[model samples]
Target: MTTAARYATFGVREAHGVSPAYERLALAVAQDDEVLALLEALPPAKRQPNLLFSVVRLLGGPVEEPAAFHDYVVANWPAIEPEMRTRWTQTNEPGRCAVLLPVLAALPQPLALLEVGASAGLCLYPDRYAYRYGEHLLGAGEPVLDCVATGVPLPDRRPEVVWRAGLDLNPLDVTDPADVAWLDALIWPEHTHRRARLRAAAAMVAADPPLLVRGDVVDDLPALAAQAPADATLVVFHSSVLYLVPEPRRDAFAELVRGLPGHWVANETPEVLGCDGLPEPPSEAQHNVLALDGKPLAWTRGHGQALSWFG
Candidate 1:
């Protein structure tokens, strides 16, 4: 696709799959040269759909209209350049807690959870957040998540997460003010609910942080897997993370999981794993396909707002 076409497609997809506010901004950026020029200023490698939106939000630009947003970008170009150069698109969405609740509840209790690509380790504390799936309510805490469920019965009890650790290429510490602020900046502008939840989750994590190690997930899985206690069920998982892994390495990571002694759970694009028995995800929008041990389980919204269980 041409540059304009790519941006347009991104805008439409984000509108359908992400947020309507981002959709407007993306569409505007596609048509306005001045706005598009600001995006072009970033490194080609950094020109992701989320990058532009994240930068604009970080700079406190309005979410609507291309021209005014363009002026803001131009006015703040000097200040924004350094941030764009150093920051990556890393959103620590705790809303995904809702999507993982059912899967965790179904898993063997007292699990030693290992999450690859766990940014800020917000997802590590599934038991710490409350969830509502239809009429059934689970967890009792400050950060409550509501999800729509289908196809399978919601698990009645929370998984006993005995131990949890996370692996990330760049792990953010929830206790660090700057790190936490960046995570907030990555959130889309109109997602006030999400932003609020992120703050609550960060506070919870700050009070009791999980073990987050920085390393290449594929290269470090075996060692980390070994560190998990043998008495507990090792539940290796990841959400929206493998897209960053190159094809060969992703395959290697899958092979490593297959060789491990416990369950492997993943929420990523269906094609990322190239596993069998998984149907093609709906092409209308981006969906995170949830799977366990290579078998497709369900489809979920990007940030876990809803779940359609196939298992």
Candidate 2:
């Protein structure tokens, strides 16, 4: 798809209903030839709506008004371009833990989780947070994640996570003010609740950080996986991450992770992992297919707002 079309698609498919501000800005950017031309100068990946908008927000540029946004970008392209090129759309949303909770709880006790694209490793502490699946509640703590779940056996308890680690090309440190600011910037402008949640989850992680490794997901995964205790169930997992990787690398990672012992949970766009036989997502809105051991189990909303079980 063309850069303009990608922006338009993101406005319709992602930002619509989710963030009206982003939707309007994205649609405006799609139509603005001047802005599109400026974006075209960057690499294709760097032209993403999320990356562009986040960079602008991070730099204290305007995003609420399209005319002001365009003027700011044009004037500040030098500053914005470098940030867009270096920084990624690492939306480390801990709410996604709600979608994985049911699967993790069903698995054997004492799981050793190794997240593939663990931005800040905020998700590594699923057991440390509470969950609300409709009226059914599990665990008890701050950052209570609520999800609209169907056909899912609401987990009776949180998974026993004895060992939690993560592998990322660029692992974010929750304690670092700058890293934490980028995380907060990635969130949509309208999501006040999510911003609060990010702060809460950040505090939880900073208090007792997990073992985070800066390495390639495909090449460095096995070494980290080996570090998990032999007695615990080693469950390799990732959410909304693999899509950033090239198709070939994603396939290689999938093949390698499947060969590892214990469960493999993937929550990504169906096309990203090429998980076949997935039922049509319950809604026309985009969703990530939640799969366990390569079996498509449910369709999950991005940022873990809801889940629809295939069973």
Candidate 3:
């Protein structure tokens, strides 16, 4: 695809669903020749325009106007170069815990939770953060998260996570200043609430961090799942992670989950599992379709900000 076309497609397929500010920025980037050239200069693997955009904003670049944002990108190309090469757009969003709540609520307590592609393992602490879904209010503490729910009933109480561990290609350490800063950089400029929540979640994990193992998800998942307590209900879960897996390996991951002893919860794009009854995602923006044991549950916004439950 042409540069403009690729970026335009990104704007529609990814950014449009994220937020209005992001959609506008992506569309503007799609049209600007200079910016496109700058982005195109990067290696194909490093050509994530959204990450570039988020990095610029994280560095205090102009975000109020598209023209100024474009100028900032051009001017800061030198500084941004290193980040583009080194960083993957790994956003460890804790807000996704809201979507996981309803599913967790339905499961038996004293669960052994294992997350694949668990960036920083923030979602592993679903019980830590407060949640509000319609009239239902759950959890209490400094970092309260809210989600709009429809059709599905809210989880009555947080699942008792007897054992918790995460698997990722590169697991982040909450105690590390640099790792924490990079996570902060990954957040969009407009979402100050999310940034604050990230910091709070990071602090919570720092007090007692979850076990995060670095390895390929498909190869390492079995061993990691084996480590869970045998008596507890083993729940293997992932959100928005499988899309990163290559097409061939995605099926392998699914088969691995199917072979496992317990239930599986996935919040990913519609086509990732190809499961029946999964709802069609919106044409304009990406949505994380939630499923439990291959049954469609709900369709949610990327960050778990909104949900259309199919319960």
Model 3, 1-311: lDDT tens per residue?
Answer: 67678677777876664656777887888889898888788777576666777678667787657889888888889998888887777789999989888888788777899999898999998878899887788878968888887777776788778889999988989889888888987776678899899999999988988989998978999999999999888999998888668789988898889899989999987877686655555344667788888887888887888788875
Q: Rank order by lDDT, top first? A: 2, 3, 1
Model 1: per-residue Cα lDDT over 104-133, one tens digit each: 777777899998988899999887888887
Candidate 3 or 2, higher TM-score: 2
**Candidate with better TM-score, 1 vs 2:** 2
**Candidate 2's residue-wise lDDT over 1-311, tens digit each?**
99989999999988888898899999999999998998899888789999999999999988898889989998999999899989999999999999999999999989999998999999999899999987898888899998999999887889999999999999999989999999989999989999999999999999999999999989999999999999999999999888789888988998999899999999999888787777888777879999999888999999999999985
Instruction: Predict model 3's lDDT versus the native.
Output: 0.83
Positional deviation of 290 in candidate 2, in angstroms? Answer: 0.1
- Against the unseen true structure, what C-alpha lDDT does each candidate score? 0.80, 0.92, 0.83
Best by lDDT: 2
Q: What is the TM-score (0 to 1) of candidate 2?
A: 0.98
Return the clash pairs for model 3, or none: none
Off by over 4 Å in 2: none
